[model samples]
Every structure is written in structure tokens, then in C-alpha cells.
Target: MRTLVSRLAVALLGLTLVAALAEPVPAQKRGGTLTIVRPTDPVSLEPNLETTAPGAWVYFNMLEGLLTLDEKMQIKPVLATSYEVMSPTKVRFKLRPGVKFHDGTPFNAAAVKFTYDRALHGTPPARWASLAGSLAGAEAVDDLTVDILTREPYGPILRTLAMYCMGIVSPAAVQRLGADFSRAPVGTGPFKFVEWKTNTHVIIERHADYWGDKALVDRVIFKVVPEEGARMIALQTGDADMVLFPSPAQLPALRRDPKYTVHETTGIRVVFVGMHAGLPPLDDVRVRQALLHAVDRQAILDNIMEGSAGPARGVLAPGVFGYKDMQLDRVYPFDRARARALLGKAGFTPGPDGIGGGQGAVPRVGHGVPAAPRQPAQPPSVHAGLGDVERGCRLLALRALPFEAGAAGRVEHVAV
Candidate 1:
């Protein structure tokens, strides 16, 4: 991960630094409410229902899955003490003893089986079902042992179990609360969910009887401030101790301030332009290649992104499993001449206004790019760059597709 300075408050600063440096550090002082400001509210507290970062972030504090990934991306046991791959389609897990959920329900093979079964066959299907589609079922062999069965030989089962969506919830609590379980979550983590007040805040208090290491802070308040400027102001005015997704433009100023810390790491997120290949014009590989050639990705990275992100080589980013440098042998350079020639060969001829049309003019390609609340202006700049590509190419027209806030699922369809 690329290095950036500290962004977390004093309570979390130690943990963040330790993870970054992989070195022992000073002991954290306990007993204070650490307020974290975010651009958007979590869609749901139920891990099975929501898959967005906002929801997952909250889940990390309140939920514990069977397995977890370390900073090195290696699978580590959490609720399950150890696991054995018995066969190509079956795996067995030994549950940790004496662990209890926040609601006092015991953590055992039953809990694991319940969690998995609920996710697989719940009335409202789990959003995570897509990730665990290969999973057939989970069975409790005994109080301390559970068996996970896949439809076939699923190699990434361990990694998939480490995902937040696989977090074990108290079966008793789920049965009691039913649909209300999403609002009032109960888990076996370091913290317990206290309250969630719509788009205002979601509060969690440190679990006194936590099975693992106790949290340093007495409470954590995830405050929702839709505006980036407002989140920054909250951090500045002590309303918030930490802020997520601060604008890249504001980083220089934040880095200069001693009162606040600005943390940066090479994230595994890849933001790219996606075209509907099944549609007209875009169906041609040459047209798509032309579009890529017209846009200068380096310029966007250096100028608009303020060097916050590195150039993406492919769909997956660095540090992610199975990421390969696809561009190692071939690179797409920014060349308008090549783009125009490719379009010309594809039967698009420049019109009087420099727009291309042969059989028919290429329709405007609509895209909906997710923008952080702090960097709303940055997306416009990016959109402008994409718009400039259409004008410069005189072959394709690109426009922003309107999308509602927090509607990330809709954006996935437009991925290139």
C-alpha cells in the first residue's frame, strides 16, 4: 500500500500505525468517545443485507466472521479456531469455546449454521448471496464443530467466509427481533450496537464482556455528514475526531495542520469507464479502443485526482488476489490520431461540426461514476475530461447518467 500520513484519531492512531509499520507502538489511552464523520449513512446494519463500504465499516466494529484477512491478505481464524478442508466440496470448522454474542447467546456451531442458513434462505435474500453462490449449505456436526458444504470445489471459500457478510449473528436475537434485527444488530465483536438514528448517526459502545481484546474507546459515533466541507468542519471544530474520504484537494491543507492527521493508502478500488458492449457502436472493439486512446488517464490521475490514485492496469487493483499487470506487454497510449483512424476504419466519417456519422451517428454513451461527498467537484472535472474526449474524437458522445445518492448497485451495470 502507498504511504500516507496518519488520518485516525489518537485512539485508533496506534492501531493504524502498527498495521502500517508492522511494529510495536505505544499503548493507547482508553475511555473516550471517538467520533468518525462519514459522507453517507450505512444502508443497513445487517451484514447480509448491505454490501457497501459504509455498511461494512460499521459491521467491522460490531460483527465477527468465522475467518478474517490480515493486512497481508492472509486468512486468519476469528470465531472459528481452526478449519480443515476435508474434501473438494466440504470443509469443517472448530468453533471457539466460551464466546458469547452481545445478547448473551453462545457462539457455537449452531450460530454458524444459523448465520449461513439465514443468509442462504432468508425471506429477503442476502446481498452477499452473489459472493457465496457456490455454497450449498452449512451443517452443525456438534456444539463446537460445523461443516461448510459447497456445490463444487470452491477454492476461495475461506476468503469468502472472511468477508463481513458472513458475520455470525445470535440466532436467538434474530428470531426475537425478526425484521427489526437489521436496526438492532447483536454480534460477538469488541463493540455492541447502541443506536442508529437514520442519516444522523450510528453509535456503538465497547462490549464489556468481549471475548477478545477490549476496544480502547468507550464508544464510537459514526456521524453522517453528507457534505465534504461539513465533515471537514466537524473534524476541525472537534465535532468529529476522524473523517472518512476527505477531498484530495484538501489533503495538502490537512497534512500541514498538526491538530489533524491525514492517512492515505493504496486502495484496491478501480474506477474506470464501462461501456455497454451489447449495445450499438460500443459493440465494436475498435470504437471502445478509440475511446480509451482519446482519454489521457495519467493527466486525470495527476491533475484531477491530485495524485491520490495510481493508474489502474486492469479491473482489479494492486494487493488484491489474482491481480496481474495486464499492461506489462501492451499499453494503451493517449493518441488522438490513432483514435480517429480507428473510428474512420470502423465507418465513422467526420461531419461538418466534426462529429462522426456514417451508417448513423454514434449515440451518446451515458455513465454514472460514484463521487465522494468531499470530491463532488472532481467528478465534474472527470466528466468534463470524458466530454472533451467525445469532442476531440468527433466520433463518440459521452454524458453523465443521473443516479441517486448511495445507489451504488446501479453503477455496477455501467462498468467497462
Candidate 2:
């Protein structure tokens, strides 16, 4: 009797929290529309087809995932009332009983199964199918009970489900709309899709029948202002409430403004350069080591990033799963003598004309070369061309180099 009462009390508490969230926002903090700007438009609004952040920025408002990450990055249930690991490769979920999609269809275990099936094996596979990660199948055992089976005992399953792409959608709406579903998204979230004007803006309105917390704003407008100056101007003129990823140079002015607040949050993005070790000069290991010793990573981080960025170790950032820190002392040290010696050992030395050349020598750039320091240990050959540039410009610069340069690519999702 005691155990039964405790379980019932916990269920009642959860219901109370849900009911409290459904109440309207207080009059003092309600009714205005919030407007923001993005650097570019989303490729597609359909959660399954889109693989970019712009799409996620808009869709997140209109969908609810089975699980969600809290401010501390811990997994917490959203659509799912509770879940249990039935076995090494299987899991079971108990759905919240009264939730409904924006279009009036009931939200249940069946809807969850349908969403995952469409994502994994629909007419065309979802763009990020690998995000499911070793999942073999999901099935509805009852209206509110679901069983998920994976090919292995995947530890990141809860985190994967928390991603915006895994948000559940109304099966009836999806079947009715087919390919057009991208434009007519229907889910159980605080906001409902209103309209999207290509290259211009996307609009969403508060869902009055939302199962969770009511939206604080009446509407949200995501406008596309590609130019950095234009985005700042919009914020200054009160045309936009927020702007995404403003350039580093703009921070000083924004930080000093008394009327506005600046929010600097931790993110998990890393930027690094890749070398083509198979090509001519780079094919030599000594040449690669020489180049690594010739560059100053700290100077770039301080001057170009204005101190917002940190020098990269390996490819992965700190605190990510499986990350092992590279010992800085053991890695290549910035020594000009060592770089020159390596080049000479590989049969390269400076000619009378002052340009570095010999058998198998890497060509040297003359202009903008920093004067060699008095100490032989200091590197003076690192190029200024390395500072942040556009994708097209970076590719062009790389192609123009004597060595082959690859285009910049984005690093997708990360797990912990």
C-alpha cells in the first residue's frame, strides 16, 4: 500500500507541474511578438530532410522531442513520461497520456513509431539517418507503450532522441501532406507554424492548446538578414530583438551599449586546418612537421578571434566523450631553426634571390613575411592568409597555393 501511494503521489505531482505550465503568461510579461535575424534561410522545414542549423532554429519552436537536455546538459523527459531499459539492446517508454498534436491528432506510442520509421525507411531516407545510430526498429506495444530495439547497447540513445530532428510529428498530418509536409509541419509544441517566405522570414504563433508551457510571446518572426551590418542595424532600431552569431569585430560596440544585453554562452564548435599529406611537398613527413612548427596558433586566436576562441589541441574540443588531451610539450614547438633545418634535411635552402628553393623545397611567399627574429627558435614564415574568410575565398586561396587545398566543411552533431 505504501509503495502504491508513493507512485500515485509522484504521478499527481507531475500532473500538477504540467497543469501549471499550461496557464497563460502573466499580463506584465505577455502579448508582444519577438523578432530575430539569422545569417541565412533554412534549406527545408521538414525535420527529417533538413540537416542544417538554420532549419533547426525554426523547427525547434514547433516540435517536442521525446527527451530534452536541461541547462546543465542532462537528459530529461519531455513527451515521454518515463522510460526503462528492458535489456542491453532494448528499451521501453511510457507516453504522457493526454498530449495532442497541433492538428488535433492524439500523440501516442504509435506516432513515435511512425516518426522513426519515416526517418529511417520512408520513400527517401532522412538526411541524418546516422543520428539514429545502430537502431534496428521501434514498435508500439500499446497506445501509450513503446519498445525500441537497437543493434547494440548504444549509450547515446537518450541524447540522440533529444535532438530536434527526432521530434515526434502527427502521423495523420504526415500521411495527408506527403512531400508538402515541410511547409505544413504539425507537432505538439508551444508554437505552431504560421508561414515561411523564402529568403525573407519564417513566422510562428503561440499554440494555445500546447500540452506543456504556454509560449511567453504571442508570435515569433525569424527574418533573414545576410549582411552583418544590417543585422546590427535591425537590433539598434528595435526592428529585431536578437541577432545570431555577430562577427567578432562587432562585439566591442555591442558590449558597451547600455540599453542592450549581451549573452555569451558555451558552444561545442571547433575550427582547424587540414593538410594534404599525400601531395608533393606535404608528402614528406619532415615537411609537414616543419609547417606545423612554423605557425603561431596563439597569435591567431588572440588577434583574429579577439580572444573569443581557444587554440585547438586535436580535432575534438575539451570535455567531449573519448577526448584525450595532446601533451603540448611533446607536440611540435614553434622553432624557426628546426623548421629551416627540416627543410634543409629534405634538400631545401634559400637561393641567392632570397626565395627558398632547392631539390624538393616548399616555395616561400616574399610579401608580408615577418622579419626573422634574432632568436633562431622563433618562426617568421606563418602566413596571414589563414585568418577567417568566406568558404569560397578560403577555397580559392587554397587552390591558388602551390599545394592542393580542400574546401571548408562543417562538423555536424557531437555527443557526450
Candidate 3:
């Protein structure tokens, strides 16, 4: 009987210990330090006054917006707990209680009013100031509720406010800091700003008393690394946990290693070369066209740019508005003879093999060879089949007579 009782007691204790271990323990929240490299530093942090997009992204994560967009690009709640659309142009928010700014200020209707009114009445060039113009009125329905009236039926009303640029600010912070908010800001976000070194880095630490679901990571270290080559090296060397823009030149080296996988998210950026239009050689549209025909875009794809870029079709990238793939088959091929023919037609007559004519009807320098032309005055159109190749031909067309014969019209690789 004694032996049985002892065995039973041991079993009971084991089960109790197992139960205790299995019981849901709160998530063990430990702070982590994440280092990221940026190509450039942010110009400013004042939400209403910030113009640069990259800096704004950092600022957005640090502040609360009434509404926010998820990965699917749909509108969702952020600072406001719940909201009701009273009319096409009006909204009422059920504010979340016990929310505090980084500076220990209460987030309320007055805070919203302070941010909006200050932007509207402060300066003509408030970062994104005109949003204040749309507000008809703002009033607190109660201590934890607020109503907002707008001037018009703004489509994507929630989405517009949800943009990263429109982070909410603390009224108390504004009152306390005044104009210096540009140098320092207070926000209700997962991380609070600790300090910044110009063109070097910015550090932020997680908020322990975050109102909603707490953040998984603790601290973020932001560093500015300009070169893609440097960014790749930094990642490999443990200097950076993340790199924003891996330069087009360094894609091959990154793919060779299997221990780390590259994470890419398609973004809304058009990385086209901005043709300077004010130069001389570029004034001749044919030279621009010839150079357009001159480059091996396929070569750029297979070699220089490699996996970093897709075949750029137009000003807008693959997913945005005004994008088309009609020009997929439209490209100037690599035939030296055709390139020479286009130059000849433009009155750029060449001797023997081919080169620009000296001292021709076109303006000439001391050697009778015309200097490089100036950039065209007009912004080159991004219409189908128009590109840097076309722009390059325009730059060289005026130098020789062989290029001028029928150069007024598009011919060969070069076209105006």
C-alpha cells in the first residue's frame, strides 16, 4: 500500500510539472538590433514637411496614421481603433484608449487638429500641406471619439490618409518643440527615434508600452550606403542586415552563395536615365536616335544589368498605370551597316569607311569637326519605340554630312 501511494504521488507531481510547462507563457520579448543600409540619408523628419520618399518611409514607420494599407494595397486600421463613414465626405473615429506618444503625450482629437491646422496655416510649402485644405471641420464627439468633415467626396478616402506620408503627430510635441520638430519628432510607433548622424546612420529602439500587438524586433539601425557594390559587401561582411538597392552591376556575385537568400519586393520606381535636354549634340534628334540604336539592350540585360532589371517598357513599371508591352518586338538591331546608313542620310557624309565629315554645313569647331551638341530643349517623349538610343543619335547626327542626307526622317538605327 505504501509503495502504491508513493508511485501515485510521483505520477501526480510529473503531470503537474508537465501541465505547468505546457501552460501558455507570454511571448518572451527580447530586443534585437537590426542594421540596414540606405543609399542616402533622409532630408527631414517633419511629417508635414518631408519631401523625400525614402526618408518619408522611415518617418511613416515611426508615426501612426489613422488608416494604413496592408501588403495587398488595401486600407486597414492603424491609430484609430474603428471608424464609420458618416457621409461621402465625413468620417467618425472610435479612438483607441490608453494610446501614448513616444514623448508620453495622449493621442486624441486635439492632436489630430494640431497636425492638420498647423500644416494648413503654417507655410505655403508644408511638406504635403494641401491635405489640410480638404478638411471642413474637426470636432471631438467624446473623450475617445472624434468626427471629421471633408470638403469633397475623395475616392479612396481611407487610402489617401493611409499613405506613409501622412503619419499622425502629437499635439503636445508640436507645442513643446515648435519649429524644432523638424530636428526632433514624437510619434506613436513600434520604435522611437534615439539619435541620427548626418549621412551616416539613424537608430531607433522599440517601445515597451506599445498599445497594440507588440513588435517582434527591438531596435533598428539605419545606415546610408550609396554604392550597390558596397551594399553587397556590407551584407556579406555582417555590416548590414538589409540592403535597399543592390546595384545593377553586382547581381552575379550575390547569387553564387546559398547560405543567404535575396528577398525582392517589386516597387514603384522607374530607374530610367534622365536624358539631359540642354546639351548641343542632343539637339539633333537623329544623333540621339542613332545612339538609341547603337546600344545592345539585350547585352545590357544579359551582362551589365543582369537579373536586377526587367525589360523596361515605359515610364511606368510593370504594374502601374499607363504601362504597355506593345514595344516588346520594337527594337533597333545591331547592324553596323544600317547605323552607317542612317548617319549618311542625315548629311553626315563620310570618307571611305565612315566617320563624321569635317567642316560641313553643320556648325564646326577648329578641326572642322563639330563639338558635341547641346541637350535638346524639350523633354524627350517616352512614347513607344522612343529611347536613349534615339536620343544618342541626335547627339552625333550634326557632326558629319553623311548623317544629314535624309536625317529629318527616321532611318536605320538613328531617328529623331
Candidate 4:
């Protein structure tokens, strides 16, 4: 009996020890407010009418389309459960069931058709019409099936549909709100529009009854802080949870600080110097080719851009579909010797008097080419305040004209 009692006591002690040793399970973080800083406020909450990236940034959380682009630019399913390309000109989509707009309107094939019809034929038409590229029409096969037709074999139709402008809106809400829809947008998204004080800030709240995954954050605030310095200060002072478009100058310091994380990605836009081929000297193919060869793109990237910008090889970036790999060195060989040889071949002989054309010929100084049709002239205020042109003229006067090759058919330290 004593042995039995001792065994029960030991078992009771083990149970107590087990209870004491076990770690407590943590509760999931479900509710918090996130504040984002932007240089500008969104022009409109309605994705279809919005054009600016700042507008899209805000609308993306409140609106969604049948498809979305992944990091690799590949199309991924969103509202649509599955899709099949029937032919080059036709595609079919199977919509996800039980999805409803914020206004409680059903999200169906009818909604898709209505959205596309408005985009294609509505007054003030969609800005992304070019992306849609010859969209014939969209038809509802049934409540959940949609058939989309293109005029020809349009390759970018799927991508176009994935655009923010193509986001499906409630037909009932559009009818009820009419022109006021931009102020109060209602969509089947993770977030619902709350208020947008134009030029100041846009606020959104989490959709509690969201169809798919629930949003972890309770609210999101997009505050406009135009100045980059102001944005950095906001981040430092904990006034902002996140900031967009921090200046490249501040990146080194931001990266060094352990309190924050810095992310870098190649941008979609390309910035290149444009010269008028219709103008004198530039009209010559050899002169144009020589100018390209003379530019040290690597040096410019390193020194001016602080290695933040990448040298553009082709007209389009590499990730873009149908991009062709070109040997950049062969095309624009960054060789001053080659540039001098090419310039001489084009009959551009620099004179002792520091002119590029010939002994008596001088460079034309005014606007090099005719302005485009309907181009407006500078305002009197702008013309009076302009100092850049004078500075440019001074720089041009100081620059040495492209000189001719000597013994080795190579010129050194030639400036333009």
C-alpha cells in the first residue's frame, strides 16, 4: 500500500513539473495601424480614372482584377479561379464563387462585362486602352463564366486585364453614386475606402468580411509628405511606418542604420539623352555613331548615379518579353580613338579657331530643331527666370571641339 501511494505521488510530481516546463503559445498579431508616406496624394480613389503611380499605390489595396503580375512579370490568377486561352484571339475565365463587392453586389461574369464595356466605350475612356490593344468585347457565358475576344491575335490582353484600370467595379454602385464614385470607391478587395482628403492623405480600413484571406492590419493611412527630407524625418521620428521614393543620396545612411531595411530594384522607366537627327552634324550617321561611342556610360553610372542606375543595353529592359540580347560593347565601344576616326570620316574637322565644322564654319547656338506642332512657347515668367540656357552656352564655349587623330589615328582628351 505504501509502494502504491509513493508511485501516485511521483506521478503527481511529474504532472506538476510538465505543466510548469511547457512554454505558452503566443497569440497571432491581428490588429495594428500602418502609416505610409508618399510624395503626393492619389488623384482619385477609382482605379479606372486614376493615372499616376501614387494613385495606383493606394487603389491596389482597395481594388483587384481577374489577374495580377508577379515579380517576374508573369500573369497570376486573382479573382478568377482558372483561365484558358481558347485561341489567339479568344480567352475564357472561370470566376471564383461567393465573392461580393463592398456594396454586397455579386461579382460575376456580368460584372466583368460591365467593367470592360465602360472601359472601352465610356466617356473619358480608359488610359490603358493601348494595353488592351484591339479589344473587341467581353461576354458573359453564364453567371460565373466570361468569354473575352480580341480583334486580332493580341498577346498582351491578359496583362492588360491585370492592370488596375481593369479592376471590376460594382454595377449597382456606379449607378447609385454616378459621378461621385471617385470619392467613395467600393470593391471586393482586402481594404475598403474610408476617406480621401485631396492633396493631404487617403485612409482605408480592413474589410472584415473579405472573401479570401483577411488583412492582418486594422487600418492603413497614406499621408502625403512631398519633400524627401520630410519623409526621412518622418521615418526617423516614428511618424511614418513606411516611406516611398527616398532620395538616392540618403540611401547609404539609411542602409547603415540597423533600425530600418532598404530594398533596391531596377526601375521600369529609361532615361536617355535625345539628340535631333534632323539637325546639322547630327544628320550624319557617322557623327551620331561617334557620339554614342564617345560616351562612357559606366563612368556616368558610377559617378553621377552612385551605381544606383544600371546602363541600358537595349531599348527595353531584359525582363520584358521579346527582349533580344545585344553585345553593347560592339554597338557602342566607349573608345575615344574610334569616335575620332568616325568623326573624321564624316568630314567634321576641328579647326585651330576651336570650331568643329571647318576653318570658318561656326556651331549654330539656338534651338537645334523645329518644335513639334501645337507646342506652346515658354511663359514670360519662365523666360525671364531661365538661367540654364546661359550656363549651357558658357559650358559649350569652354569645351574643346572634337579634334582630328594624329600619328596613331587616335585622339586623346577630346571634349564635346
RMSD of each: 6.0, 12.3, 16.6, 17.3
lDDT of 2 by residue, 259-289 (tens): 4444444343443334555555556787667
What is the per-residue lDDT of model 3 for residues 110-161, given as tens digits with 9 covering 90 to 100?
Answer: 7776666666556654656554446654677886777776789765556556
- Report the C-alpha lDDT of model 4 over 1-416, residue by residue, as the tens digit: 00000000000000000000011225556888878876766667776677556778787887789998887779898889898999998899999999999988899999989888887778867755656777877899999999999989988788777766677888999899998898888789999999889878899999988998999889989898877689767766778767665544566665665554444455443334344566665677876676566556555444444444566655555666665656565677667677667766777556554445542342222221111100011111111211211111111111111122222443322121
Ten residues in sequence with the least summed lDDT for candidate 1: 10-19
Off by over 4 Å in 1: 1-27, 257-263, 328-330, 374-383, 389-413
Superposed Cα deviation of residue 8, candidate 1 (Å): 15
Clashing pairs in 1: 274-416
Give lDDT for model 3: 0.54
Best by lDDT: 1
lDDT of each: 0.69, 0.62, 0.54, 0.62
- Steric clash pairs (candidate 4): none
After superposition of all CA atoms, the RMSD between model 4 and the true structure is: 17.3
